[model samples]
Target: MSGTAELAIDAAFAARLFDELAARTGDAPGITRAAYGEGEQIAHDMMIREAQALGLTHRIDPAGNLYLTYEGRDPALKPWVVGSHLDSVPHGGNFDGAAGVIAGLCAVRALIEAGLRPRRSITVMAIRAEESNWFPLSYLGSRAALGLLPAESLSTPRSDTGLSLRAHMSRLGLDPARVGVGQVHLDPAELHGFIELHIEQGPVLEAAQVPVGFVTGIAGSFRYRAARILGEWGHSGAVPRGHRHDAVFALADLITALDRLWGEVLEGGESATITFGEIGTDPALHGFSKVPGEAGFCLDVRSPSPACLERIHAGLLHIVAGIEAARGVRFNLGARSGSAPARLDEALRARLAAVAEGCGAGFTELASGAGHDTAVFANAGVPAALVFLRNQNGSHNPDEAMEMADFAVGADILARLLARDDND
Candidate 1:
């Protein structure tokens, strides 16, 4: 253990930051930090101001990812990067993405206040556009920084504004062309490791009665955002059951079949999740007395196991074929988008676990069901670890509640980890 283990995390600093964030970005029902929008800009600016106050060097990439570095004894060693994204889902809780960034700041602040600098620098990152609700892309800022995002994605439009990503970057005076050409800002090989501290976003930590969790892996997903089922419309009273070709009934059959497959997968001791997040018929065309002719839906399937993901996808195709043949419906599954599962660095995880144990913070190992920017780093060949703070009422909603005490415990662990000398 490092001498900084005796130093306490600056939790008060984190509280003030969180309160200020909520006040400035509050969106009535909750907070709305739209990706690359005004609210998100406010967050980045705030982080910059805080970095300036801490006397840390700051830099911004072409994609507007923020990096604030606290200098250490050695300038040549690869820095330890700590951070998470700053954008949130529409009307989302205040803590979902912001907590991780704040935790990074808190950890760095603690080290600085203790008058101790380790061998390698510590960089607190503020990633952007993590909420796919705004940009329809995964790990937008992180991928851009690591030069992993495809050039075609630059033309993808924001959901609410319908403006291309390139246009948005230009609006903020950022170089979209550089990002599109795969300019690297934070190279994976130049970092010692990456650590992200985020809220649990689920009941797992709370149920386990632990204040924090060390994540083992993050779930990958396959998504169909604009799938549709088409069939002939007819009068409900006139169409016989055998003769009717109903799109709604066909959708129902598809859902039932998928549900059965999901249950079977679970019974087989495999982990997977299937969700029909959005499903409905066209309100303008359908009537109460009419048999629906068309229905649209979106599907999101996730699993930590790549083989399991493939198995489920295969079952879905088979089920869709049978449903189409029996109901005489045409299925149009739109462009598929997804990411592969990520495995965290086991050695780094063990080190953090030891640090947490030394700090007397209760923690357990688990796998994350939600996607995060940490997965981007792990996929880029960087050693990465994710720490989850206990939160209540789930996440991506206004009711999410993470205790400040729990956050302090997590931050303390991070501070201890960063304050240790490389030789130790």
Candidate 2:
């Protein structure tokens, strides 16, 4: 609505898109939607529609990533790609990934409506699985696009559920090998820059009274699912003190040990967190599964830097192994998901900051506390930047939002960044 300055965005379109996104989130029939479900497809369709309405060329990657391209002055240039994921964590807010996608769409709207054309083409992509429950890790689609996708991901199992990613892809008519790494020509601009507009998904910016932010770099994640203990379940009241194996009790011991090591990690000020985030017992018994069976649970050991995570992982695994041995619990440690820390494009960051200043959008430099698809480009050697909007504390919940005015400012900044030759 601000008729485009050097760079501007359509606040009205962004708000409309956000509302539409909320509508699409539950358009399909289910309480929870995983990566390849019908719900995700519906979500993908809504994004495609927005792109079509904008008159941008549209396509979906073999991995189900949706891209809406806006032609620049030179139609031949590899476009400056923007936008984020459309998937959400189980009950996540509609705005987390959705806002960024809309922001990208609005970027183009602002540019075209402002009656400006650039040397580089522009694209808004709604990548898949950034919040995937099926992949068991983040950034699957973008990694594939950047050629960093693991060869083994196709056969990788999601938890103990028998579904393999390969099978899911097959069902969706996608061959996993070619998913994120498809036919887009990485033109001059693409070689140098990539920008993503996303909600802050945390309380910091809004609480600080800032309307926008220039991200320093996104933090990395290092985690291995810990099957730290395996114990036999027995009759609760009948099991003798030393003669029986109470698997839950041993798991409790392991959890406490993990807590202590986590305390040490917190004390180091390295932005580390070790969460026993999820768990599964032998049976979901009403009151009795008294067969004296097995017990298990998961552990999430994560940190922003790969180095710090590695150190913490090594020490914690050692301590956990020790706990397993000492507490009469058996251990079956599972494999770890490999992670790379992303250091954002500095030149892009500076340009974005300048854009924020020009737009009069108060902003702060910060780090992304969550995993994002932008890291895929960083891991694959592309210059990438993230623009974060404000959200209060409710990530992975139903109440996420980006203030209309704040989102508009961030969009303007993103447009400027995209329009600049700002990559180093």
TM-score of each: 0.98, 0.88
How much is 8 displaced in model 2, in angstroms?
4.7
Error of 2 at 188 (Å): 10
Residue range 125-240, candidate 2, lDDT tens digits: 88877775667766877766655566767776654357887777778887676643343423323554678878886777977899877777676766556564566666767777
Q: Candidate 1, residues 151-211: lDDT per residue as tens digits? A: 9999999999999999999999999999999999988999999999999988999999999
Q: Whose TM-score is greatest here?
A: 1
Compared with the true structure, all predictions reach lDDT values of 0.92, 0.70
The alpha-carbon deviation from the true structure for residue 258 of candidate 2, after best TM-score superposition, in angstroms, is 2.2
- Residue-level lDDT for 294 in candidate 2: 52
Steric clash pairs (candidate 2): 144-180, 144-181, 145-180, 233-292
